[model samples]
Target: MEKGIKAFQCVEWVSKRKVPHTIDIVDPDPSWPTTFTQLATGIRAALPATVIHAVHHVGSTCVPGLAAKPVIDIDLIVADPADEASYVSALEAAGYHFLFREPPWYEHRLFALYAPPVFVNLHVYGPGELDLESARHRLLCDWLRKCPADRDLYARVKRESSERAKANGEGVGEYTEYKGATIREILARAAADAAAAGQGREETVEAGRAETAEAGTGIE
Candidate 1:
């Protein structure tokens, strides 16, 4: 099937189900980590050894003291995704189905857990060089954990968006377009901040290097 059609099909499938925004506001269960640990172990076993770099439990489940859906999000860094169609199929055989093929988010290939909303989201990103996946995952988790004030704001936005979408005819595409906008905004802001921080770190390193050179010490 065409990618667009497949996306629409996924949306249509999701549209039939109902999810309340309260799902977002609910306190996260402490067992979330254990569940994620089990998921990561299962995925590590199922994946082809060659393609794997690191499989991690990301998203809200990985962050302590953060509210999130009960679902688990796992990130996989592959050596080469384009060349590993077989690995994708292997994952499919393990009961994960392709849901979103989001390229805007750094060549991401998302697979959904068969159990539905509370299921797993496997984010496949290429190579160890692509730090975007892990960085974004950490940023979101950190932001939510440290900034409790944003939690309700996020929840309210999510709840309002969810209700609005449901009223206006919810489906995969529309739901994604709606919710994805918020996610994208958060990501964009985080990315800008990371770039700035990286620049500052480089500057600090350069200053340290000058000092070390003056001291006649070799670079570490």
Candidate 2:
């Protein structure tokens, strides 16, 4: 599918059934990474290697010390997410329930696994489809890993959002929306830091090249 806002107009819900649940944000679990590793392993084993591009542990659960909902969010990059025939049956056989898909928004497809002791939100997308959104996820995760201040700030917002959602009988969607502003603020900081780091690297490389050229001229 062609990617862009025009594609979003074709958003389709595979199932309209809503699952009832409370928004419970918990303290960081040390086991989250291990859980992701095991899950990723199973997912890899289930599908053909040719179709799988990358599997990433994303979202709040992946960040250490960051409070988050117990659910783990994973990003599974496939050759073509819109081509469900290539891997959907395999994922289902592996216990993932196929969820809705947003064809316009990066050819995004969602799958869920509600097994006890571990809940997972498996997000599927094509390689180049999630360029911007994927970058945002990467930057936010990298920044949270190193920036204690923003991590704590995000945790506080998550708790507050969860509390408000529970009090108002809202679902996960509302809870996520409640904390959107804070997430955007943190992402902005992360993007600035990333840009600065990239510029520094470019300048350093240019300086090294200039020094090498000067040294070569003197040797002759």
Candidate 3:
């Protein structure tokens, strides 16, 4: 939970309609943690031994007292995400559908489970790629968790953004864009805090890499 990858007790692939295009921010639910734990367990069971390096419950949902859009955001850190063929097939068999491959975004690979009982955005990233996204994600989450003022501000901005999107007939994409300003502001503060504490992005990426090394390329 400290923005570092930790090996979790073991923890998908398929296809279906993508997530809904609407944005509806709701009060934080008590069940988010349970959902994440259950999902992590399922993922561990689905994958072959040693395929996953670390499983982290990231995003706003992971922060207590933060309102979110009711969807889980998970960061699936691997040794080398670019080597998708090594693990993608096993994930597909677990009922997770490949959504997109965005090399420009840290060679990120997104997978999702859109059926009942679980709605998650599985973000896969490797250590060698541009690790900006993973660093920012964990930093911001940890920051909001520690700072109550920012947490309230984020909740307010999210609610207003969601309402504005609904009133203006805007979709989730637009809502996300509308909230980008606030998100950046918060991230700026988080980044500053991280730097002041001598924590750098390279350290974060290396943490994942270290885990992968410990995991030892054991994909089946």
Candidate 4:
């Protein structure tokens, strides 16, 4: 089932939706993809083939050259997000314990489970119900991959956030959200830049099509 998943669909989701946070700007671990591959395999084995569209490593940890919290943020694109009960039942059968569900924020249902300190955060997003979080996350990672200066700036914000989290002894949500807000601004800028580039590409393609049509008409 994992082998049947769509790679471009992952790209499309990132391009379309607005995600929560952007990339982490620091040295990356070469083993990130290796970790994700292992996770995806396990998820594929657990999830029912009918409901799981694709399981992705969509958070900062997935992106290379980013400093993440060492937690894997996996998105299980289910057929229906509201069918949390179905997933709850099925996953529990597969040894995953349901932890927290936050519906107010984009109707996104969160689940958690511990496997010997390899803590995983699972965000279940239903089909056609995407909010701002996913796309925002993709843009942040994309921008950092292309622009080193912005990435450096992001790393500093993240480090400062880490310090605050340490000094104040804050929880994961608080630390994540505060630092995330800063990255969101950068995501917005990257989004605008991307929109402009997309428009330019479309215009060029349209112009070529028009020329082709004119030449065809002349043949008649």
Top lDDT: which candidate number? Answer: 2
Q: Rank candidates, lDDT, best first.
A: 2, 3, 4, 1
lDDT of 1 by residue, 1-220 (tens): 1222222233212121223212332456788788778777777788777778888677656667655556677778777755547477787788777654544333556676646435666777775435344545655555556556655555555556556766787633443455555555554454445455673233323322222110100000
Q: Which residue pairs come into collision in candidate 4?
A: 17-135, 18-132, 18-133, 18-136, 19-132, 19-133, 19-134, 19-135, 19-136, 20-133
In candidate 4, position 54 carries an lDDT of 72
The order of the candidates by TM-score, greatest first, is 2, 3, 4, 1
Worst 10 residues of 1 by lDDT: 211-220
Name the 10 consecutive residues with the lowest summed lDDT in model 3: 211-220
lDDT per residue as tens, model 4, 81-188:
767765767776765555444443334555554553345667766654342344344455666777777776766777777677667866444555556555546655
Give the TM-scores of the predictions, in the order they appear: 0.64, 0.84, 0.80, 0.70
Model 2, span 1-220: residue lDDT tens:
3523433266577864335443788878999999999999999999999999999888888888888878888888899887899999999899888767876666778788886565887888777634334445655777889899999998998899889988998877677777767776776676667666773233323322222111100000
RMSD of 4: 14.1
Instruction: Tell me the lDDT of candidate 4.
Output: 0.54
What are the root-mean-square deviations of the candidates from the true structure over C-alphas? 11.6, 11.8, 9.1, 14.1
How far residue 186's Cα lies from its native spot in candidate 3, in Å, is 0.6
